[model samples]
Target: MTPFEPDRSEDLLNRLKQDDKQAYEKIYFTFSKELLYAAYKKTGDRVIAEELVQNIFISLWEKRQDLQINNLQAYLFGALKLSVINHIRSLVMENKYMEYQMLTYSENHQDTANLVDLHDLSSIIEEGINSLPEKTQEVFRLSRYQHQSTKDIATGLNITEKAVEYHITRSIKRIKEYIKNFYIFL
Candidate 1:
């Protein structure tokens, strides 16, 4: 690879600021590989390094009009270092979160893989509701499923609004208790 000549890089950056395509290509050819290798040395990941380099160039291009890059290499390396550090820190945090979640799952007793089907769970819940006394079922369906206001349902059913409120609250508490134990296992 040809060494990056500072004079040429400065002239190219100036011309690229004026929207010259040739200058842009010359800059890309001269600096892309060196910047990639520099970033990769810090990141140890080709994909992340490549992405950082790409972002740096795009940022440079966007700010070309106001850029005063006395030393192109220094400016590029500074940008590369910042980008790589940010990427690595994020990766470290993500790995820590995954490790913690794995450990939490292992300590729980239930076999997550043997959990009942979600569809079956829903069917079982509906069947249980259907088996309730007729009055409780009507109040449960109106408040929970149909989303009717208790006051409106009480007016329509000619019962006290307190009775409607009591039935909905009890049904919701029962559903919550049932799901809580199952979810902890998962």
Candidate 2:
């Protein structure tokens, strides 16, 4: 509404700090929609925007007694902005981790690629591949050889992505063992 007029706001704030449910509901109904719109404009995700606003209200209620504010609108907007930045930072870190995983497990095979002939190695790798059960072998090939994402492999194979991950892990462990033993004897 019109910023809750100062006298009413002061009364509501006092009730809120005292854990009055109706006062909390009053504040939520007044500010939540506007906060959601502001958050959506900043984050460009409707679901995340809604979540941020809900989190703000929850935090407001939990820390109501500790909060002191001359302008409630300013406080809510400022808190939403900080929460949005934190969410963006978390997403960026998750993306970087996925990229790191892809690069670490990439097909470059750096160490042995330089020391061994790929033909000999491929044959030894083939031995490891042949040893796997059929379904595990399929998932591993899709993930490693074809460079398909776990999502893609899961969709293509009609299996859960977690299942694809398990198969990839099982196959990689078996193949690495084969390669390591081959290196030791050489």
Candidate 3:
């Protein structure tokens, strides 16, 4: 592939800002492969790398009018870096939640029937939690599993108490809805 000329890149950016599909397509075709490669190198997962690259392009299109990108390559790479970091952080949190659940279940349950029921319920709850948005999942795990207070979560996450409360409430509502839907399907 030929390198994008500085003048051509500026023109493409201008056309992209005006919602030109061809310009967007050109940008995607130009940078997507490299972005995917970088993401894959960082994540070691082809599916996740492709997803992250796709999200970056989608965001670029969605926010074209509002973006002020003097260096598109740098911006895209930076976004990829942050996305990988967030993904890793999310995986860590999920592993912690699973470990906590396993410990709690093993320590408290002895009867076979109780164990079966608990396993089913735990699976349902885990699915519900996984369906939540990343920040909400984090907030819910911190609040419920770690037993952190709202104030503490807010402080730790660098958000206001109100935001922490909002996330907790939203997570609970969504998880309840998920559980309800799951039972209805059963």
Candidate 4:
């Protein structure tokens, strides 16, 4: 590629600062390929390299009025290098976030599986409660399901406190046996 003459480069820079579209186009055509090659060499990806170079030109145009470029070529190359570094940093952060999300999802999946097992155990216990004698079912339901105290259960059922305790113990023993047999069959 032919290098820009010193006088011509000075003229281009002055015109570019004044928002001259033709000057901007000349600069783009002169430097775009070199910048793309440099970006690709650093990043090793053609698409990313192209995007970085494009963004550099876009930023140059947007900030043309504010730019005080002593050497346009050096400035463009410097921007390309910084952009590539930032892109790599973003990729690393994205990978770490994805890994964390995957770990959390796996843990949550295990919790969901445990909840399903607990639900099945609850259903089995309900079946055992249903199989109890009618009076025992009333006492067990009042004490466990309704969260009533043993004394309250005896008063409500008009039974002695000892009878309430006996029914609770009997219900627990039968449910434990039912659960053990159910798991053995599974």
Number of colliding residue pairs in each model: 0, 0, 0, 0
Cα-based lDDT at residue 2, candidate 4: 47
For model 1, how does the per-residue alpha-carbon lDDT over 11-86 read when each residue is reduced to its tens digit? 8878988988788667767788999998888888875676678777767777888888887777878888888888
How much does candidate 1 score in TM-score? 0.51
What is the clash count of model 4? Answer: 0
User: Which tens-of-lDDT digit does each residue in 43-102 have in candidate 2?
Assistant: 999867876787787679779989997777678889998999988986886588557646
Give the residue spans of candidate 4 off by over 4 A.
1-5, 107-186
Best by lDDT: 4
- Kindly report which residue stretches of model 2 are placed more than 4 angstroms away from their true locations once superposed: 1-4, 107-186
The C-alpha stretches of model 1 lying farther than 4 A from their native spots are 1-3, 103-186
Which has the greatest TM-score?
Answer: 3
Quote each prediction's TM-score.
0.51, 0.55, 0.58, 0.54
Q: What residue pairs are clashing in model 3?
A: none
Instruction: Output the lDDT of residue 96, model 4.
Output: 82
lDDT of 3 by residue, 135-158 (tens): 999999999999999899999999
Model 4 has an lDDT value of 0.82
